[model samples]
Target: MALTFLFRFADDVVEASDGSLYFSVASTKFGLHDWFFDVLEANLPHGQLLKYDPALNETSIVLNGLCFANGVALSVDQDYL
Candidate 1:
């Protein structure tokens, strides 16, 4: 099954070799059109990096408090994000 999440906007997405999905939530308070506003407000880093594991059928927040979680990539060794 596919996992679903609700957020104001989504940015980059990358999949791990182990079948886990890592994605970014651009902002929790604004959409693309309001990107400037979000930047202007500087409102406490409402963005996040999330992870979804199909094997466990669960999703979790890997990181939070990012100014704008816009990118996601795995390390060269594939050992870290």
Candidate 2:
């Protein structure tokens, strides 16, 4: 039998009060052999900022292709969100 795996690399994350989670995923390429070597070739990790709202049970992409977007924070008023 063949086995399958799901690999996800998350660099940073933040949570919102409305039961929402925001995070960034870094770009990575891998092979069966010496996968760690690929990390060096990743250069600039490009990915999107995602928001998962548990109340609505939906995941939305707030921003895309943000290079090196490591942290996220909401506005003080929360109204701007």
Q: Count the backbone clashes (under 3 Å) in each candidate.
A: 0, 0
For model 2, name the residue pairs that clash: none
Residues 1-81, model 2: lDDT tens digits: 422223244566777777788876553233335435445555644555777778877667777655545567778866644
TM-scores, all models, native as reference: 0.85, 0.58
lDDT of 1 at 77: 84
Q: Report the error of model 1 at residue 35, Å.
A: 1.5
Error of 1 at 63 (Å): 0.7
User: Which one is best on TM-score?
Assistant: 1
Model 1 whole-model lDDT (C-alpha atoms): 0.85
Model 1 Cα lDDT, one tens digit per residue, 16-80: 98899998988878898888777776757778899989899898888878897789999988988
Note the Cα lDDT for every prediction shown: 0.85, 0.58
Q: Estimate the Cα RMSD of every predicted model relative to the unseen true structure.
A: 3.0, 6.7
Q: Which residue runs of candidate 1 sit more than 4 Å off their true CA positions?
A: 1-4
